[model samples]
Target chain A: MVRIQDLPRKNFLMPGNAACPGCPETMGLRYVGMALGENAVLVIPASCSSVIQGIYPRSGIGMPILNIVFAAAAAAASGLKAALEIRGLKDAQVVAWAGDGGTGDIGFQALSGAAERNEDIIYICVDNEAYMNTGIQRSSLTPYGAWTTTTWTGKKEHKKDVPLTLIAHRVPYVATASVGFPTDFIDKLRKASKIRGFKYIHLHAPCPVGWRFDPAKTAEVAKLAVQTGLWILYEYENGKFRISPLSRPYRDKSKRKPLVEYIRLQGRFRHLKKSDIAVLEKYVDEMWEFYTKLEEIYK
Target chain B: MEEDHLVLPLSRPAPGAMGKTGTWRNYKPVIDQGKCIKCLLCWLYCPEATIIRHEDNSVSVDYEYCKGCGICANECPVKAIEMVPEVQGGA
Candidate 1:
């Protein structure tokens, strides 16, 4: 286990930020910031992060943050990176931090362009599973049967395979991390900072207000997500697939926690029916099987 | 390679049982006695009934099943209950 005392003492974020009581995105930023330090340029879109950082002259981030439109984060980060290189500043790492709505939905075109071209920048999607900044609305990345403002009854579609979609571009690196596992997240950021091509980190951030969960249970929900196999952590390095070790045995239907355990904590999924949970469980099982197969075939 | 496959364990503990600590929602509640007026608001609001009533009528929060919603603190008329940050509780 990674100890907080052994980590660097430099603090990149200040208190009094605008994030809700248990915003997991802040933890994600804390880990990434520790890994990259002051030599990093962050590009954020108009999302929860933008609000969290507050207006200019009162921003929470100690490092430089460039605020841009929702759909232009990736493209803008690429431009900033190239500009830095042209100015003979190749040491600084350029990073794009965006929300699920920005990366998985609106900014996908720009992200695809940058990844296809193998731009030298890190693009992180801090996914709370929906367009939370605007409202608790459904986005392309919202999981199946999840409740959202847009999906009042519950989402009918499965979350888009965002990591796989990026891997299709054959980028140098792509991985998934969560604030619940800070050491893993920090390690991924350190690795991404050293890599020289397009890199993507899909971070699972829990939004307490948006999810209607108790502020204190955010990390618990994040851990449940991975333990339930509803959110698997994997990375594709140069077309090679590597999954995090199964922290425990596979959770088959008979042994799995009731889907309601994962759903009831968040008010968003309060409207889901028993049949909806069953459908979601089936999908989770199928996805888990598919991922295990990938590991076996690739090995 | 075939022999190596045999080295792997045949089965492991159930996923939910392996950690035993259910989801990350496990939290302990704290009460600020200095701010408390012995109003018993926390005792009445505790969903798990984990609050203990002392002979003096003072309330003590139990950590075993407390979800730590801070509702008790918010609802406390005397501002006595406070949500103490657990080491690994929040996101």
Candidate 2:
């Protein structure tokens, strides 16, 4: 339970940037900056961050950022880490920050290779659930029954479990965090910094414009996702898996809020009918069941 | 050989890189000092990093850079902040 006053005062994600009002990317990046401080270099791919970083001639973010291509963020970070080591700058952390489209789809190969080789770089996948940078196109991580520009009738496939995929790589650390819980995210970033090898933090950032929700409800919507048991916050470190303290109470089915409370808030889930809600709820239950089994095995 | 040298356009790090995004907002958040608890939750969640958390634990909104997202007002547990229209002359 880190206090607000206890957090670092340095603002790495400076104001007057290109980020939209109530953008979750900015919120998450704020925590990342507070945790890592001045000793970090971000590897950003072709995503909203590339634009939010502001156009050439002036940059918004305080940290050094290496803007790479769509599918080369993780690979670039790995090489950057090697370069830093050779230059006697081992303390400088190289972070690969990418969107779901770049991480789950295009950059998955590079990310997996780095994870397999156990590269010492922090790879953060800011999952906004779709290709939000280039309008709302459905991506591999987009949940089922969610409306997107490409999926007008709602996506037919379920959201890809990227964290679990990373965990299978037996990485040193893998955590799921949300923009709603800034303290939890900040704590996780600090923890990841201490560990060596591939550290993957899947940050759930709800996009207001793409999700068709009120800009102010960004935090509210993210909170509902976790409260409804739709998005589980947990960490996998060195083969030991456990739910985060914030989400521990939600393990009990009775304690969890109804899935509709989370879904109805977003216009993207408006197309979901009663039957669709039921399916989504069942999917949530299955996900919980998987987590419970995982805890039993590893905890 | 001198003509073959590659010269690239570069952007320097600076605050207000987008140039006073405060102009983009239609509504701005106004904090009621009496109701404020000095919780600094608004400061924690501000996307623009425009909310200044002073040394005394008091929080103030820097309207010059704040895009007026209403997130500060929305997330305020004490309901100390309110969103007001920027242009008072408009209906």
lDDT of 2 at A193: 94
Instruction: Report the CAPRI category for model 1.
Output: incorrect
For model 2, what is the error of residue A236's alpha carbon versus the real structure, in angstroms, after optimal superposition? Answer: 0.6
Which of the numbered candidates is closest to the native, going by highest DockQ?
Answer: 2
Each candidate: what lDDT?
Answer: 0.73, 0.92
Q: Count clashing pairs, candidate 2.
A: 1
**Candidate 2: lDDT over CA atoms?**
0.92
**Which stretches of candidate 1 lie above 4 Å from their native place?**
A1-3, A246-248, A251-258, B1-91
For candidate 1, give the lDDT of residue A66: 81
The TM-score of predicted model 1 comes to 0.76
Where model 2 places Cα greater than 4 Å from the true spot, the runs are: B1-8, B89-91
Model 1 clash tally?
Answer: 1
Model 2: per-residue Cα lDDT at residue A236: 93
lDDT of 2 by residue, A35-100 (tens): 999898999999999999887778888889989999999999999999999999989989999999
